[model samples]
Target: MEQNLQYFLIPFLNWEMMLLIWVGVFAGIWVGAIPGLSVTMAASLLISFTFSWDINSALALICGVFVGGVYGGSITAILLNIPGAPAAIATGIEGYPLAQRGEAGKAIGLCTTVSVFASFVGIIVLAVAAPVIANFSLKFAPRDFFLLAVMGILLIGSIGGGDPVKGITAGAIGILISMVGMDPSTGEMRYTFGNIYLMAGISFVTAMIGLFGVSEALTQFRQAGLKSPKQNLDRIIPSWATFVKYLPLSIRSSLLGVFIGALPGTGGDVAALLAYDQAKRSVRNPSRPFGTGAYEGIVAPETANKGAIGGAFIPMLTLGIPGDAVTAIIIGALYIHGLKPGPMLMIETPHLFWMIVSCLSISSIALLVLGLISVKPFAKIIEIPKEIIMPVVIILSVIGTYAIQNSVVDIFYMIGFGIIGYFMRLYGYATGPMVLGLILGPMLDANYRRTMQGAEDQFLPFLQGFVTSPISLFLTLAIVFLVFSQTAVYRRWRGIQ
Candidate 1:
């Protein structure tokens, strides 16, 4: 216990480590607030530059980036309706509406406060229950992952806005677009159509920038004369009573994030969406309806994604598996530093686990201070004249798209999607479902294919797996309940009206 305490104190006591963490968090927030700059990309870049740095320093910086980047995504989502990362897409649903209603400052203040709380929740779980969660995570099968993806897809109904049919149409189109690359297992070209650019596959990040960032700018152009919403900067932070009122929900969503993040191949994005859906179903008499500036909607997803930051480390530290893409990069860093990651990792380097926990804890503190300070500036961006802001948004979207793999073609694709998104909005189609489909389509396809292959392409045996395995059975039943909950009868029975 003494040794563990010493390990945990290393980051807190070392000034260099502390500074690096703060710097990393500061940089990560900017990177993650940009449309195409992702936490994965930032971590990978850090790995390249920090190749010669001490392992402890390198890990501290990366951990800071990991925590801050996830939180940063919500900044753009609330201010501009463009999520810096997919994890913040659900946040944009409620947050953008709040921005339109001139409550951007208050919404972001609440988001920052709850995000810090959730980060602590995740870290506590990582400290206390990591081994158990790691063991349980290994029980998931391909079919179970497929089921999880399906559950994510079903969220179209919740975030679809007013028209269910249009939402499903947009989602289906996104799934088709996601299929335009080579099949992972078979190496067969899907919808590539002999074009070289399409052969490599469309990046969801590029699509997201175009759909949310560029499209939003174009939509603003249509309402050229309307003044932007006047932000309410006073009373930015919620009172203790307000925070306490949402405490139960914050805890629930944060736990859900940890659990989902621990699942290999899933991450904060899925957790946020799931949490948003759960809040939609369970939070009776919300301040306002979801998709229209409800505080409950903002609270659910922001907390869940922040909680995922801790959850993501659980599988990576305790087992060899990465909980998400950022952790996957950290695993590479571990190998580069001549350390093998797996069950024996903790046994061999006991200090490593504790140091990570300590570093993440510090990162959360940095986020709270920095996040609160920046809320006013971020909210002010929403109030800028559309003539000035819209052009800048377009330019940023282009830069963000091109930064991903340095491809000019992606910029063109983003612009095209922007045009398409503008028209879709004009016709009353929400873009959230489409982006969700893009995010989850590959997961569903790849997992379903792998599961089918495991069953030897036999339909009956494939079906039996859902009932045979305990984990699979539970997921299957949950999916059933989710589907049932969408029905009118179920909604009425639950007093959802």
Candidate 2:
């Protein structure tokens, strides 16, 4: 405890580290609350900025942004019905109700508090349990990874709560988008339309911005001059009684967040959605339905999404496998600082490991303070005019696209993709499928190719594992469930009296 406490306190005394953390926190909020700006883009930008900094300072900045970005999303969710990040989708459901009811301050405040508490809890879990979890995860084979991928696919239900078809279609589209780059197995180009820029496939971050940001901006034009109604900034603090009342949900969601976040390839979005679904199932309240603004709804995803912070760091520290894109970047930062991650990392650089964990814990406290101070200003951004907003968004989109590689073609690509996203939205097709496809396309490509390589053109032995391996069996079942989720039989089964 003494040694751990020392590491925990060390980061606080470093002024350079502190400034970076603050920069990350505020910047994360600014970008993350913008509908199109995802954490991945922000982190990607940080890679260039932090190239010259030492590991600790760089980490402080990145981790602070990561924490703030995850929570910054809830600001937009509460202020507008649109979720800044997919994780905030649940927050919007519960938070928008609070906003509509003229209690925006309390809703934001309570979730902010809950988010911090959940993040701390996740850190504690990571500090205590990462090694055990990593050991178990290491035992997982290719079949297990495939099963896990299937689980990610199944999350479309959570993503498409009201419209299962839209969600599945979105996921399918995301898969296709993911396939845009080179064919890993055959080394062939796909869906590139013969452009040299298409060689890298679509940028997932760019697509996320176009789909969520640009498309959403266009959607706002439909309601020109109509803003999401603003509410009085009520008591910023939830009453102790109210806090106690939702404590159970907060704790449950936090635990759920950590578990899902710790799983490699799954991050806060899935954790928040999973906990949201679980909360909906567990809450037996016929008196107040979820969407109409139950406190439990507010508590569930808010806490869980924040809870994923600690969980995401587990694999990054212990196994060097990033739990998410943000953590993946952090891994790169660590390498730049001359810290290598592997089995010997624990023994070789125990102090750095402890310091990283400690810094994670500190950022949570910092987020709570930062969140409260910024909530009022954040609420004001809701009133910003769209005419001014869309132009700036388009500019940022162009700049962000070009910034990725100083490529002029990417600017054209962003504009063209933005148009595609806009048309897709107008026709009632969700852009989510395309964005998801962008994220997962490479995973499917690489893994499927590797699987084939092992089989050496012989398909029978590989086919045998689909049923025989526990992981493959689980994945196959998940695919079946996902495919049949919209069918009468599955719906009937799920809706059984």
Candidate 1 lDDT (Cα, 0 to 1): 0.92
TM-score of each: 0.98, 0.83
Highest TM-score: give the candidate number: 1
lDDT per residue (tens digit) for residues 65-156 in model 2: 88888988888777755566777867776777777676777788888888888988898888899888766656555555655555556656
How big is the positional error of residue 415 in model 1, measured in Å on the Cα after superposition?
Answer: 0.7
> Candidate 1: where is the Cα deviation over 4 Å?
none
Model 1 residue 122 lDDT? 98
C-alpha lDDT of all candidate models, in order: 0.92, 0.73
For candidate 2, give the lDDT: 0.73
